[model samples]
Target: MSDTNENKLYGLVVEFGDSNALVKAAERVRDSGYTHTDAHAPFPVHGLTEALGIRRTILPWIVLGGGLTGCIGGFMLQYWVSVSAYPLNVGGRPLNSWPSFIPVAFECTILLAGLSAMIGMIALNGLPRPHHPVFNAPNFERASGNGFFLVVEADDPQFDLQSTRALLDDLGGAAVSEVYDD
Candidate 1:
């Protein structure tokens, strides 16, 4: 309990043998009211999200707003330039040619939506995070291979070192360890 970063507590990590164990542990953690818990597995584990109780993200709404803005802005830019800024009537065709603007507007909609999705996803996920305390967990690299792990962050209100460790130990996990910020 020295005033140093190395001694800073990050969380408790537990390794499960398989996806089923991981999912069940997540459910138990959620039911026990541990808000800052996370689970990791080598591959996509079905029912993990439901067990974690993670709510849907609002990124789709953000992307939709971007697309709509792009569409309207693209079409308006063309309309203003062609009809008001410098009207050019050629061969009895109206200066305000709406049909010709469709392609560009459609492209803008797609472009903005794609950009929004990419940027929003990255920003929302807290990207560019080169380091995390979970990486300090024992055998954590196996998370991408054969590991299924659960992490209960120390910042959670219900996270007591001894009790959390005991809870994980009692969950039939293969191993349990502490994670440090250093």
Candidate 2:
């Protein structure tokens, strides 16, 4: 890899077998004055978020905003088409009748919220570009099966190459590897 590619990975990889072990390791790493750490597991591990001190995601807020925008847009479109741009008299009904607009507004809200959730999740996860340094590690294919992995990023102020390795070793990690950015 070129120098530019080498600058991407900045961490240490600690391999584990079980969720319990991974959670314990995460807690240890978090308490070790390290802030940039991530964990990978074959399945969602309960309490893992709490262990990593991860805050609630902002996707809900994004969805809410999108839903609100959709509602307003739908209402405005119906209002403009029925009340302002072209008003039609049907069964002596008045223009700007809100009851008839509810269905469109509701559908738009659902559509926008769903779209926002999908897009927000992808955006927040930094998707599309596929390469990851963890893939370079041997036997990492098992990560999607039964393996559990924890990575403590080197950018953390407390991360020292030697000390971090030593810490992982002391934490009963099955294997520890230095992750390069490039």
TM-scores, one per candidate:
0.92, 0.93
**Residue-pair clashes, model 1:** 0
Q: Model 2 over residues 96-170: C-alpha lDDT tens digits?
A: 888999999999999999999999999998986589876766578878998899988878888888898899898
lDDT of 1 by residue, 3-76 (tens): 35557888999998889989999999999999899988889899999999988899999999989999999999
For candidate 1, the TM-score is: 0.92
TM match of model 2 to true structure: 0.93
Model 2 stretches astray by more than 4 angstroms: 1-9
lDDT by candidate, in order shown = 0.90, 0.86
Off by more than 4 A, model 1: 1-5
